[model samples]
Target chain A: MEDPMPFGTALHDRVRDEHPDLDHLVRVATRSGTRIRRRRHAIATAVTASGVAAVAIGVAMLGGSDLRSGGEPDVAVQPTAPASHPVDQPPRTRAERAHARALRALQDAPVYVDSPDWRCDQPLDEKFICTHGAASVVVVWRPAETWADYQDPAKAGPETFISDVHGQFFATVNAGPDTTHAQVVEVGEALIWAE
Target chain B: MITDAGKDSEDFGDFVRATGTQLYRQALLLTGDHHLAEDLTQTTYAKVYASWRRVSRADNPVAYARTTLLNSFFSHRRLRRSGELPTDPTLGRESSAPEDDPETRLDLLAALTILPPRDRAVLVLRYWEDRSVADTARDLGMTETGVRTRSRRALQRLRPLLGAELTERTM
Candidate 1:
């Protein structure tokens, strides 16, 4: 029996005859991976610098507080301690507290990678790249204040949530087929890129 | 040792060779112009290549590619609201005569261009791809009811623009 709608099939057949050069298409596809990898690296470097600065300020405050209290400053002490502990001591400034919180949250956050073989290079110049063979993934931090100032909250997904203490925002990007938009959002929440 | 990245490149190259033409054809219909169709097809392949590891492992890689192509098309349309025609003259000229009567084909392409991107997508998936209503709905991220409604409306919209001669060809 003949199909009732021959026009659709005819149109499809006609269009199919117009073939494009396969080599050109393949070249473009291959190049896109490199472009994505470069962009991800740049973003990761920017985010890591801010994270490191926050951590340094947090350490300075702890050391300063310990010295003023006539106690030996513990370099390895966690920054989760309250800023208003000593009644006679001056309280930490708002910026100090925020940095402390952000650093703490980032330390506790999970790292998400797309694959097990991917490994992050040691932080050098506040930048690191997680690589799996030739593919690379980059994770970056964007503070909530910065995100809110620039981005529309309504468009952001749940993964775009900021840390309760420091108001830090994070996002991830990579040059891989599996690094989808939803996966990027999930990476933002975890602040780690693997795969 | 053959690296994973090397293997990925080889596999992606093969996939593009096998499916590039079919995808370009679909893009040509979707865009109604050759140059735009080529750009759209290339972008789709690039996205598929970016997620090659996962996409290749999918149960139906062809369907995945098609979905990617449609999403790319709609996103481009949304980003650029202009109805600017292709600047290249040589593009639309090549396929101007697909059948004995060139007028019918031209009219069909014209009518398709008039429909909104989403509406055109619904019709193409339904008729050209011969996809079921459920599949079309899932592909377009619309409800089955919405697909049916859009399909009916798009056809009605195309019917008037296609005029009497081309309308009879569909039936």
Candidate 2:
């Protein structure tokens, strides 16, 4: 019996012969590039405008004499907290402050740990683990690190704590002396940051 | 020295002219429809053009282009789950009413449409493009063993549809 190479070659040749001309491919590609550039420019403009508007609103709210009557001048605005919880009088205990900060960082994250018994535990020096039912996340507070360290956690050092939930693994790593980053990575999926 | 942007555009245009037809052929085999194949080819070229600076610098740009094309095809397939070419009974009847040299080719393509996208990709890359099993695995983002298994299974599936004449020699 002969090899199937001839048959495969014939098939390839037929398909190749049937392909239409490539004159329009370059045109389509150029148009696509233009479209992408326009999209990026529009997004950037929107982001910049939003940032400016937010800053203006913030300044207008804080600079108004009525809003700043009794509060400390040095403290920035804390929009998230209730009116009763002033920025100048943050949680007094270090653990409470850390927990608050962790909650703020993860406020916009897609996944949430929904157990009623969730508690943050400091198992190691400057390391906190919060668990609720099957879901748990560990946050490590580093003193002074660069953003690059957060981007490449593998180079930062060994993982302090790792927890697996729903086939996704979460790890906390010291990015720098002052920087800590938490990341969740699932197999065949992109790395998602908890920041 | 040419500016980077000018050089990138020129290189991309040249690359498209050089290998566009071959990529279109591969797309045709993968899609089993001429229109879909053309769309896939154009999309692939557009991606390559967008990433021209990096892709043109790659050691094997052809392989990179092939990988990009396969990725575009698979992603397109994923986005439109029910949008694959229809294999209705009427179309099957029309396809069975054979012509001369085109009959065997149409039969081969018809059989190919039954396999899953990844399996079809494996077969086309292995047989039509004559890629090594390792290369096919890498292109499909699968293990070598996975590629082998898919290739064997794809051939088995095709044998019945393709009949003994086409299946006997190579597969």
List candidate 2 stretches off by more than 4 Å: A4-7, A41-195, B1-7, B79-100
Q: Pick the candidate with the highest lDDT.
A: 1
Instruction: Spell out the clash pairs found in candidate 2.
Output: A142-A178, A143-A177, A143-A178, A144-A177, A144-A178, A145-A178
Worst 10 residues of 1 chain A by lDDT: A120-129
CAPRI class assigned to model 1: incorrect
Model 2 lDDT per residue over B1-171, tens place: 899777777777788888988898888888887877887787777667756767778898988889888997875554232234434323323332333357655766666787789988988888888889898888788999999888878777666665444444555
Tell me each candidate's i-RMS in Å.
8.0, 10.8
Residue lDDT tens for model 2, A89-134: 5566754554454443243332222222444432222333454343
lDDT tens digits, residue span B50-139, model 1: 678888999989898998899878755532323233223332333335454565566556557777788878878888888899998999
Could you tell me how far off, in angstroms, the CA of residue B10 lies in candidate 1 after the best superposition?
0.9
Candidate 1 stretches greater than 4 Å from native: A52-195, B78-100, B163-171
Return the clash pairs for model 1, or none: A112-A194, A113-A194, A113-A195, A114-A194, A114-A195, A115-A195, A176-B50, A177-B50, A177-B51, A178-B51
